[model samples]
Target: MRLNIKITFFFLFITKVCLAQDWMQTPIPGIGNIEFPSDPEIFDQNGVLIYKLENDDAFYLVSIAQTDPSYNAEIEANLEEYYEGQLEGVEEASGGTVTFKQDIGIDGVSAIDARISGVANPELPSLLFKRFVYVNSFNVSAEFRPKKTDELEFTALKDQFFNSLQLDVSALGSSIVVDEVNGEKDAFKKGYEIGYVIGRIAFWVFLVIIAILVFYFIIRLLRPKKKKEPKATASKPVTKQKIECTNCGKSNSTEAKYCSQCGYTLPRD
Candidate 1:
């Protein structure tokens, strides 16, 4: 009886272990959800969830976040950088050798896919596959590895994770990429530059017009004023005395003192 009880207890324990390993689907608020291994380590940093799954041979990390608005115009160029940019520290941390890397698209969304093999620590050489997907305003990345201390095998695991991804289109928002002709110069920037140039030209034109008006007024104010001429007056005529030359006329009797023909004095009135 005790032996049967012990057997039953062992069976129950085995069943519990199996149940613990079963995969489960969970929804991440504001993002989407996926079927991950049971009891995966989930961390929420700044509203973003960083989920991690591990086994005897490999480990996987999946994270989702929104794309920054400042980087929207250069989305295409940013997608090109799979190694030196976003994965800046991976090579240093894992001492891994990148095997293959490529850029792909799905339903208008852009992505980067890469595979690497390296020693994560002193004991084991790990193989890792990483995929970065750009969905509208969000960015989703997954790093999968096979065995922590085993040979690098990524094909099977890569397929599993990629297949299970369920993205919520509404949560991703709208695409932020801006088509540009020059380096990072979009329509807004170009329009602003053109507007600035036009504004400067208009300001100079206004200044020129003001200067011309000022010069015209100044010339008018500096001109000399005309003086008025004085009016002419008529002069009186002078009368000549008849007593002149009375002494020589012979009719010089009337109170004549002297006459003009001879040296004589004239009478006073």
Candidate 2:
């Protein structure tokens, strides 16, 4: 019927309208070593990454390494995101015969000043590739060495790429800056620091207040309630009944005398 069709269309329209109101665009900013940076100031702009790994093995190795603490689980997580972002994007994805090294910052905030080089060729590669991958072409410098080589050491560095203790940045530690110095606590900046401290204090106070209120309500509920006694009502007079003792085979208290068969006393009497 025309009415049903109109009603259906109306419902569909209402659903779409509600959906539009509830719609939210979640932008998953790719995290980790390999990623798609959308900042106009970086890369080829247009957020397009044209690089591809010529070395398939190196890509896999880096992917594994990223999961280790050093890479912040970005290799696996970021590559997927990087590749995903590359797909159906303003950029074309390619990874072959290309190598470069670059310092990567997370969301342009915290930075890691290091080189990332991916090489695939292995007619005879050095022992360095035992821990890191050999990529012929990467974004960062291939020959960049560390100043503090012996600062930390890892025995199982080769076995696990996503090790948190192997001079590897973990997903948790890499991008998160929990213990920060941002207050007048630093003699360098007083005004901003004081404001920050105030804000932090307010946040903690709010949490404590909420916790206290929750406890109060819980205690109020757990407190025992007084039970009401049922009202007594006058009814009928009760009647008594008698029974026999099976062991002695004697009858007692049919509201009567003891059994003549046995010398048992009457229960009711």
Say which candidate scores most in TM-score: 1
Candidate 1 per-residue lDDT, tens place, 103-220, comes to 7664456677777777577664467677777655567788776663323344555566665666676765443221211223233346656765786676667556655655565565
TM-score of each model, in listed order: 0.47, 0.20
What is the C-alpha local distance difference test score of each model? 0.60, 0.32
Task: Identify the leading candidate in terms of lDDT.
Answer: 1
Worst 10 residues of 1 by lDDT: 176-185
In candidate 1, which residue pairs clash? 57-147, 57-148, 58-147, 58-148, 245-260
Candidate 2 lowest-lDDT run of ten: 35-44
Per-model clash counts, in order, read 5, 38
Tens digits of per-residue lDDT for model 2, 1-269: 45445545665565455333311111111222322111111112232222222231222122221123445445534543433332222112121222322233333222222222232234312122212221111122111112223424322222222221122223223222112211211332354456557866766675566556555665666689889999999899986765785548665567556676666664542
Backbone clashes (count) for model 2: 38
Q: Report RMSD (Å) for each prediction in the order shown.
A: 31.6, 23.5
